[model samples]
Target: MDYVDTFITVAEDCAAQTGVVPKPRGGRDTVAVLQHRMISAAPYRLTQGDVLFSTWLLQQGVDPATVPPEDPRRAEFFAVDRACLRASPLPKTHGWGLHFDAEGRVALVAVDDPRYADLHDSAGKVVKAMRSSRAR
Candidate 1:
């Protein structure tokens, strides 16, 4: 399987093992939302780096249960706020961040100053494209 499949498998396994519900927000399913409202209100966008990271997570077989509660990756997977973004501390080159809202809607944020133009690409569209590409 590809990296995205691997990550999704791990996340799904983690949810199944923990009995965590896959909450949907704005038709997107996620595990948790960051507490900060400002981050939650932002538009849903995704970057090429975000897609790469998701693929990497899948390939590594990362599981939420295996990730430490304090691990920044956990926050990257779950939280949607500036604090979480700061905490995650992604490389300067990796400017995009992802999170879920209170309603479990998945959203993306641009971390680097003077964000890239493509960062505004609709997350839902990106996700759909990713899924379609993966199916092939």
Candidate 2:
């Protein structure tokens, strides 16, 4: 399956597990927003391996926030981390990069790229959701 399919599949599973529904929107904009949210809401306790995979998923338009806690996609997601994929290594790829910080929260660096910036606003919505959830 292509990235879009992978993203939708993962999103569906995440929604089922987390009870967080992803609003469907047409075009690249929706994908971008979802991807940003995934990166931002991913659990800080993720293993280094998970962190690497989460980064790759972010590029592929998977939102961590929407990921089902028990989704199999998370296995593949974490696998990428084990492989240690790097954005600088594949600069030509449309959406391939890993951005994380010492705090484990999704750093803004990933969104800084022109390709990712467009989704920042939508991702902000997801971040708010995450904050609310954490506050509870």
lDDT of 2 by residue, 1-136 (tens): 1111010111111122221323446544343344345444653344334445555566676765577667788765555534322211121122323333344333223222553344333232222111112222
The positional error of residue 85 in candidate 2, measured at the CA in angstroms, is 8.4
Residue range 21-56, candidate 1, lDDT tens digits:
224478632223221222244433322233334433
Candidates in order have lDDT scores of 0.31, 0.35
Among all windows of 10 consecutive residues in model 2, the one with the lowest summed lDDT is 1-10
Runs off by more than 4 Å, candidate 2: 1-44, 77-81, 85-136
RMSD (Cα, Å) of model 1: 15.5
lDDT score at residue 98, model 1, on the 0-100 scale: 41
Report lDDT (Cα) of residue 120, candidate 1. 30
User: In angstroms, how far off is 2's CA in candidate 1?
Assistant: 26
